[model samples]
Target: MAFSPASYSQNQPVLDALSRCIAACEMCADACLHEDHVKMMVPCIRLDRDCADICRLTAAFIARGSDHAKHVLRECIEICQKCADECGQHQHDHCQQCAAACRACVEACQQYAG
Candidate 1:
């Protein structure tokens, strides 16, 4: 993807980090849905989906070189944090892995959002 940033180099790190976060979120969402207890995994599944969507949009915003990328980054951080908290509640391996991914995404997004 090409981003038309006012200053390209300034946003490169943010763009890269957002891309990783989006990938993680998508993987985690898929993992959660594969869990045996479908009913208990509902919230996790939903949050994972939400987080994935936000991360993707944030990446696209940054890629397009839009000045509004910061706003999406902030929102993505919030969603990642929430998803991490929810996933952290479970003892399953997938949940634990998803939580870690979300936390990483949160930190990365926060750094860029600033």
Candidate 2:
């Protein structure tokens, strides 16, 4: 699909960041499921799923040059921040990785939002 030069250039970093965040959330969710206290991890798993879905949707919106993408991206930033805060409470490596990803996404999204 052809993208307008302005939209394509503006959204490149947002798309890249969103992709990384999605991958991180998916991986973290899988890891959380594998934890010994899988039942106790229900909330984290849910948030991870939510964050991943938003990131994916945000990327799609930006790619399609949707006018409402900035609004969606703002919401995505909020969700990523919440997910990161939640994931940071864990001691597992997966959660740590997820926290980092969330933080990175937050910064990227903030840049786009500004």
Off by over 4 Å in 2: 1-3
lDDT of 2 by residue, 24-107 (tens): 899999999889999988888998999999999988877886778788888999999999998999999988889889889999
Q: What local lDDT score does residue 57 receive in model 2, on the 0 to 100 scale?
A: 90
Q: Against the true structure, whose lDDT is highest?
A: 2
Clashing pairs in 1: none
Candidate lDDT (C-alpha), each: 0.76, 0.88
lDDT of 1 by residue, 1-114 (tens): 334546577667766766665666677668767777778888888898898788788878877767787777778888989988998998877678778877887876676656
Clashing residue pairs in candidate 2 are none
Off by over 4 Å in 1: 1-10
TM-score of model 1 (CA atoms): 0.80
Best model per TM-score: 2
